[model samples]
Target: MSSNQQSDNVLSLRGISKTFGAVAALTDIDLDVAAGQVVAIVGDNGAGKSTLVKILSGVHPPDSGKIVFDSKTVEIPTPAAAHRLGIATVFQDLALCENLNVIQNLFLGQELRPLRLNDVAMETRSWDLLRQLSAKIPSVRVPVASLSGGQRQTVAIARSLLGDPKVIILDEPTAALGVAQTAEVLNLVERLRERGLGVIMISHNMADVKAVADTVAVLRLGRNNGVFDVNDVSPEDIIAAITGATDNAVSQRQARRKEGLSS
Candidate 1:
């Protein structure tokens, strides 16, 4: 985590540690995300990035930690609990039904049926949500299979908003998109922040992180390597933290010299 902390964070985690029997997945991690902010979690493979996401999503309870949401410390023990606390997650596999239309997919599990199926209301809401994000979907009546990769991602993200969540966790949202598609999704992320929602994006794409993230948090070998303001740090330094490239003898010598100069 960074040495500085935000005074009005919507979500704050402290000393969060988790283990998987013999392997220590995460150790003493700290993170803060404020409303209208996009925090990107970047790490190399097996660097405990996914583990930390699971803990936050309530797929796995942390072995030790404190989780504060809206300035209140609370325990998230299940996915339902996380949802109840206004936390929503969109995993890499969008979980959308290709055979169903946009509206069908959006209200699949939680349909807005008072007496019978309210198709009109559901379809209208689907369009409203997509319009809010400025999504480029062709029609809300078309099957999801007919949509492009970016459109499918937009649908999944829009579905996560059904409950009016305050925080949204997106895992590799643009991992499989083309250049144009990636830009479309990134624009949606910006809109989410504009709506005052806290966004946590887990991605390996440094370019994407640097493009949209307000803060970039780097994890190295199950520990908090560093958290940087995206504008203040260079891509080279962020990559160094991800690969431990800055820990060599030459880098250490340079660090010592820089410290001596500062002293």
Candidate 2:
């Protein structure tokens, strides 16, 4: 969430707090995702990154506060309802079945059926989506297991876009990929932004964050620390925010510096 992102917040989360029994997974989180921007959320282990995504994906509900999607504050209680509102989440696994063909995997649960399953229409629609996204997979009929990791990932993302989602949240997209595959995934993310869809990328790799993110948002200990334009801050500064080792990141490091002086 950059300063530029502050101007046109497509998604606004105000004081969103969530708890589980005695465990406070998130507290007082405020974030904004503007149109056509990819915001990366970086943090360490137990930083509550997964929990935050669950909240956005309708796996968990906030105990307090509000979430505004497309200017209207709303509550997302179920995955299907979230899909209806155009929020899609791609998990770490990419979630594609190896035995299935590209088109079969793409339209798995939501197969298009007129009187019966419309195989021709479904495959044609898949082809159209691949073309629209400019994805590089060669054949839609090939088994997913036969394709490279990057191509399989492309299928996962293409499936997400079928609903014309307003925002897409990607969880550790390149965590297990090789250097080449990582680059490919980053390029795909760039295409997502070019298509005007808001992107929330969760990664442990700052390198990946710096590569494709328009904005960087830090979550330390299940709380929003700060959000900044990628060009406005350094990687070290972002790390400081992630560890809460520096002063106040939300207030632009001034609060932390002033506190240091007073102390």
Candidate 3:
């Protein structure tokens, strides 16, 4: 994307730090998610990826730092605040009502209540949203329990869009999905980008990241270890960053070999 496009970033974080008692979960972290771009956050366990997502979703308030949404510094004190600010997050659990059908689940808590509940309009919009994402669900009247893993993922994603969020965060979207199902979810991700929405995906699958992410940010021991352009950096380099071994003996030896070859 061009600099102008980047300048229209929907979300930004600067000097964001979080601590739980004595354990520092994050340290001076910085990130940016531009419109129509997918930024994947990859890290090993205890790398503070979950903490960062919580901070962004207002599940946990940051100890210190600034969160910039749509060019304005804002405070996200709670989940409702995050939603009101046009930020939505779909966690791994999905939190869907298994007994409810697609349309009912989509409008669950925020239903058009106290106004005769516009089932006709709500169902219509639900179909429209599914169509927009190219989702493959046989029927909107079937319970979520009957849907496949990938179909459930699509529903979770589609529900998040009901708020018309500018930035959406997906946590392990393709987890537990079969090869075909994984492809389905990835296609939905691309559609989100095509709609000019900023996507921040937390995924451990390198292939998925490489396939859809425009940029990858590596976190190590709760700090910003590295950020790389997907097209410019190799998977090895990203792995090195994730493992905090970019300057280790093995990497140094490899570097020396390359230098010798060049000379």
TM-score (all chains, Cα) for each model? 0.91, 0.89, 0.92
Q: In model 3, which regions exceed 4 Å deviation?
A: 1-6, 113-115, 246-263
Whole-model lDDT, model 1: 0.92
Worst 10 residues of 3 by lDDT: 1-10
Write one digit per residue (lDDT tens) for candidate 1, span 6-112. Answer: 55788999999998989999999999899999999999999998998888889999999899998889899999899899899999999999999999998988998
Q: Taking the tens digit of each residue's C-alpha lDDT, what string does model 3 give over 1-263?
A: 47786568899999999999999999999999999999999999999999999999999999999999998999999999999999999999999999999999999888875479898889999999999999999899999999999999999999999999999999999988999999999999999999999999999998999999999999999999999999998777888999987776657777899999999
How much does candidate 2 score in TM-score? 0.89
What is the C-alpha RMSD, rounded to one decimal, of candidate 2?
Answer: 5.8
Candidate 2 local accuracy as lDDT? 0.88
- What are the clashing pairs of model 1? none
Q: Please, what's the RMSD in Å of model 1?
A: 4.9
Cα-based lDDT at residue 198, candidate 1: 97
**Regions of candidate 1 where Cα sits further than 4 Å from its true position:** 1-7, 247-263
Model 3 score (lDDT): 0.94
* C-alpha lDDT (0 to 100) for residue 205 of candidate 1: 89
